[model samples]
Target: MPKALVTGAAGFIGFHLCRRLSAEGFEVVGLDAMTDYYDVSLKQARLDLLQGPDFSFVQGRVEEPGLLMRLFSEQRFDLVFHLAAQAGVRHSIEVPRDYLDSNIVGSFELLEAARAYPPRHLLLASTSSAYGANTEMPYRETMRADHQMSFYAATKKATEAMAHSYAHLFALPTTMFRFFTVYGPWGRPDMALFKFTRAILNGDPIDVYNFGDMKRDFTYIDNLVEALWRLAGQPPPPDGKSVCAEDSLSPVAPWRIVNIGNSQPVQLTDFIAAIEAATGRSADRNLIPMQPGDVPATWADTMLLTRLAGPITPIPVDKGVQCFVDWYREYYDC
Candidate 1:
């Protein structure tokens, strides 16, 4: 069986990816720090669902010295997914040091390890927030994303550059995918969909930032996972040319960046309405100004993703929101 190493295995995206890889007959090694960014119980619960012979769990920080190096040496992963990072825009503002440690230094450790033991494919998760302050309607991989409004985005952008250098120098096959707003069952508590669901079910006021004028191209977890799985097998060659016209293939390395998103931006108010429709409760809106490090809109141009991974049929926001609500009720016994 193929050996796969997934960092941040306890994270929302990492958990889903590990489960999917394991079910596909891969020997999966999941590494997570299990940080209390929200609740350690949630991470533990996700880990419980992934416990099986094919899936092994490791409790450790990726930023720790020699942690990833040791694992990579022993496991010799055929595929590596670097999904672990300090995730949170507002929180980054509060503690920018965490972003430097996890996003920058942690990635440095992983890159060094991958250099020692090269994987068939190394996929790193990036965010659409890296497109910071751009007013572009459909943000594409080829667009300029240098001006990041938040420290979180700056670190992610920096990682992309760092990964690219490794791919160019060490001949490491790398693919960095930019995720829009990812929401689904087993979502993180800090995300809007999860927070909205919990507050609405409890009959509490849901904070509506920017007076509900924001928009996001929310990608469903299942669809994103499928895209990721397919991409794993379709690593870019060292020829440094795009197979498709819209491809973001690098000019000097076996690396590329793809945006996995629904490609359909939905309004914030409409998103809340979907939650209301799902929960059968009207939300008490606490309209407020847009917080710092927040963008008014985010839409992805998924042409590159489609070209590389074949056709991607994304789940609609309303349907996706309902799925999360159903899971939340079942999990919390609402």
Candidate 2:
């Protein structure tokens, strides 16, 4: 069986990826710090599900001294999925240090460990927020992402550059996947979908930022996980030439940055309607202006991922919303 080490195994995306990797017949090593960013219970619940015979758990911080080095020395990971990060947009404004610690220093530790024990493929999770204020309608993999509104995005973007440099310098096979608005069952509590669901179900007013007029290219978790699993085996080869001006793949590294998103953008109001339909309650919305570090809309250009993953980038928003609502209902018994 192939061995894969998944960081942030207790995170929303990490949990889904871990489950998918285990199902795909990989001997998965799940590592998580189980930070109380939201509720530790939620993290524990996800871990409980992944705790089967094939999956092993390690409770430790990725940025800790010698933690990754010791792990790499113990086992040769065929693939490494670095999904762990301090995730939050507005929170970064108040606690930027956490982003530096987790996304930057943690990734540095992981990379240094990989430099010691090279993996066949290394996949790192990035965010569409890294696009910053790029007003491009459809965010392409090949775009100038120079302006980042949030500290969270800056750190993630920094990690991409760091990973690319390592790949170029050491010939490490690396893929940095930029994800747009991922949501589904077992989603993060801090995300809009989760917060909206909780508010609507509990008869509380859901905060509608930007007067509920924002749009998002919300990628369903399953579709994103499938794309990630397939890409694990499709590592990019060294492309040491500046062949063209259009390509985003690193010219001197075995690395590529692919955008994974639902090509369709849905209005925030429509997303709320999906939640309302699922929970049988119209939301009492508190309409507000767009917050700092918030974008008005995000739509992805998935030309590269579609070519690689066969035209199935995102599930319908209504279906995806219903799946989350159902899971939420069952999981919370409400």
Best by TM-score: 1
lDDT of each: 0.94, 0.91
As a whole number from 0 to 100, the lDDT of residue 37 in candidate 1 is: 93
C-alpha lDDT of candidate 1 relative to the true structure: 0.94
Cα lDDT for residue 163, candidate 1: 99
Q: List the candidates' TM-scores in order.
A: 0.99, 0.97
Query: Which RMSD does model 2 reach against the true structure?
Result: 1.5
Q: What's model 2's TM-score?
A: 0.97
Clash count for each candidate, listed in order shown: 0, 0
**Tens digit of per-residue lDDT, candidate 1, span 1-334:** 9999999999999999999999899999999999989989999999999999999999998899999999999999999999999999999999999999999999999999999999999999999999998997799999989899999999999999999999999999999989998999999999999999999999899999999999989899999999999999989899977787778899999999999899999999999999999999999999999999999999999888887778978888889999999999999999
Best by lDDT: 1
